[model samples]
Target chain A: MITAERKPLDEIIAMILPFKKVLVVGCASCVGECAAGGEKEVGLLGSALRMDARMTTKELETREMTLERQCVYEFIDRLTGLIDQYDAVLSLACGAGVQAVAEVFPNIPILPALNTSFLGQTKEAGLWLENCRGCGDCRLHLFADICPVTRCAKQIFNGPCGGSQDGKCEVNPETPCAWHLIVTRLEDRNQLDLLEEVYAPADWSKKEGAGPRKIVREDQQN
Target chain B: MKIESQLKNVLAAGRFAVTAECGPPKGADPEAVIKKGRILKGYVDSVNVTDNQTGVVRLSSLAACVLLLQEGLDPVLQMVVRDRNRIALQSDLLGASTLGIRNVLCLSGDHQSFGNQTQAIGVFDLDSIQLIQTVRRMRDEGQIIGGEAVSPPPYLFIGAAANPFADPFFYRVIRLAKKVKAGTEFIQTQCIYNLDRFKEWMSQVRDRGLHEKVYILGGITPLKSAKMAEYIKNQVAGMDIPEPLIRRMKSVPAKGQRKEGIKISIETIQALKEMEGVHGVHIMAIEWEEAVPQVVEQAGLMPRPTV
Candidate 1:
């Protein structure tokens, strides 16, 4: 899921200062799972904004609401009536969700309260680890399910590089060397022969090399 | 036979070869490279000019190799894939060839975080194996990576690094085989302190008959002091230094440590000379090129072989 962290309180406050009345919107999807832009976080932010207004002697009003999903047009329509009641919409969603809100309410300025991090999994409580680079092409099977493109520091195909030691990466001692894991696991399965063949250079055009990528299924798009 | 490589000829002649490394200075001074090249001129078969070794920015290996060529020494141009994309790598290969560089060593350089520029973004567009293939294609097939025809493709001898001590001990030989399959003609290993492990790696290579397909050069670096030994054993990544080697260094007095280090390196060279499938010894006397000649002579490898 897409993960994010709320921007510092000062940056958010500075962004909302010009608007006397602000609508704080949260998404209950990816951001909610990561506990960054869930309904509870929206409530907390709303109270903090109210406190700032009282301490600064400013006539500011904050109304908090959480949508089932922010990226879908159907769920974003829920804010159509409430958007006009506020000066600006402060979105506590990922970049895609913020853009979706902006598309739905083209006139109202959309502000992002959280910084979208990466496509990752919550490895454990309070720890999120990025597992995918969204490179468009995926070859996880050949590497024993480990993504060298995202995990290896050099993104080396024919590795582990010389910097690998004790199953740890030279870049960071804490991070496990992806190639080491691949080799060791494959050897256990009697599949070490898979690494014998030199991997060819990646066709990066499938990723950002050609520019922003898009896909359209002719049968499902209409 | 594919390229005019003095180092290749020395190895092909079945003579035990000796190679040394020359690191480029940090500043834009040609004198440093020239001085080191002069020191290693007649002592070794070919000199490898390091490419931003340890990720520290320095004079380029290409320019340093050119200086060595001017000093009447055969140079092995070390090219790292960390800072250049395929286009730039190919362009530099052509440039190096045009500048009279005949041998090339391909490597995935040390991570930039280990260098002065910790925040730098490494441009590993192609890994070392792919770089070797690219060079081979350019040299043998006369085609660029994009399949464009070159008017005159670069004729070069390709070399790649191997670490027998790095993790998954069983996979190290397989990695070397992969490099050989990728068109690398020679293999230069990381410095050897644990001779037992290196011999195990070589035994595996011989088991697969990979030694006949590619030349293996064992790496040796003389430790200047016990402190340096400790730093290498603890701080240097992927290094497998036996505790006894450091103990030996500490056993000597402060002033005698340098001589003791040279003696240790000479012993390693002598041991490597008798090992089957071992083509040569690459003494990477890091920052101590002057000690190379004395080490080479003391190892009884002097009166350099002319192929």
Candidate 2:
């Protein structure tokens, strides 16, 4: 899932300095799973903003609302009549959700409360690790299911790099070297020869380079 | 022979080759490299000029190799893919070759986090295996990675590093074979303290008939002190210094431990010479290049083999 984290409290407070009325919008998807921007986080941020307004003797009217999925038009349409009352909408969602809201309501100022991190997996409670780079092409089959493009510190297709010591990446001892795991696991399965040839340089054509990548379902469009 | 390097010639002539390493200075000091070369001169077949080894920035290996050449010492230029993309690596290979460097050792170097700059980016455009293949194509086929032709291609005796003690020990030999299949003419291993494990790895190498395909050099680093021994055993990554060696160093008094370290290194070389599929020994006297002559002399490999 796309992961995100709430921006620093001070930065968010400063972003709303000029606004008298504000809407804190939350997404119940990826950000909620990562605990970065959920309904609870929206309440926490709204309470902090209200406390700041009271302390500074400012007239600040803040309203909190969470959609089932902020990236969807139907869910965003739930706030159709109410969104025009706020000076700005602070979105506690992934970048997609913020952009979706902006596309629907261009008249209102859209502020991002959460910083989109990566497509990641939760290692355990309270810990998230990026597992996919969304390189558009996947070679996880060759690496024994460990994604070297995202897991390896250098994203080396032909590894383990000399810096991989004792199966741990030199960049961080806590992180396991992706190739070490790939090689050993492949060896165990009696398929060590799979990594013999040099992997061609990654094809950049499939990547989301300068613009947003979109896939059109031509068969379903009609 | 495919490449005419002293080390390659000595290895091909069915003689045991002795190689040493000399790290470039962290500052602009060619004199320091020359001084180290003088000590290594006539004592080893080739001296490896480390390329920002251990991710610590120093004088460029290409420049250091040139300085070693000026001092009449053959330099095996070590090039790592940690800092350069394919464009830089290919151009650097050509530049080093134009400057009369005949030997090259390609590797995916130590991570930048371990160096002075912890936040540096690593550009491993090609790992060691691919780097070896790239050099071979440039030499044998006059082409770059994708077989694009180059005018007057660089001819170099390619070398790659192997870690027999790395995890999943069974795959170590397979990795060596992959590197050999990638077109490396020679192989140098990580520093050795346990001869038994190295012998096991060599047995695996020989079983695969790789002995006849490439020259395998066993790496040996002389311990400077018992503290260094403990540090290597406990702290250094991928190096497997045996407990007995550490005990032997600790058993001795502080003054005599360096000698003991050299003694153990000599014993390892003597044993490695007899081991099947082992072609030579690479004496990595880290920061202790002056001890090269002493170690070579004591190892009975003195007055190094002539090409």
The best candidate by lDDT is: 1
- Chain A TM-scores of each predicted structure, in the order given, are 0.96, 0.95
Q: Could you give candidate 1's per-residue lDDT for residues A1-222 as a string of tens digits?
A: 999999999999999989998999999999999999999999999999899889989899888999989999999999977899999999999999999999989999999999999999999998999889988889998999999988999999999998889999999999999999999888878887899989988888787766768787899876
TM-scores of the models, in the order given: 0.96, 0.92
Question: Residue B131 CA error for candidate 1 (Å)?
Answer: 1.0
Q: On residues B95-128, what C-alpha lDDT tens digit does candidate 2 reach at each position? A: 9888889999988888787888777888776767
State residue A189's C-alpha deviation in candidate 1, in Å: 2.5
- Segments of candidate 1 deviating more than 4 angstroms: B1-3
> Which residue pairs does candidate 2 place in steric collision?
none
Report, for every candidate in turn, its global Cα lDDT versus the true structure.
0.92, 0.87
Candidate 2 Cα outliers beyond 4 Å, as residue runs = A56-58, A68-84, A99-109, A161-167, A187-190, A195-198, A208-222, B1-3
DockQ of candidates 1 onward, in order? 0.84, 0.47
Q: What interface Cα RMSD is found for model 1? A: 0.7
The top-ranked prediction according to TM-score is 1
Considering summed lDDT, which 10 consecutive residues are worst modelled in model 1 chain B? B1-10
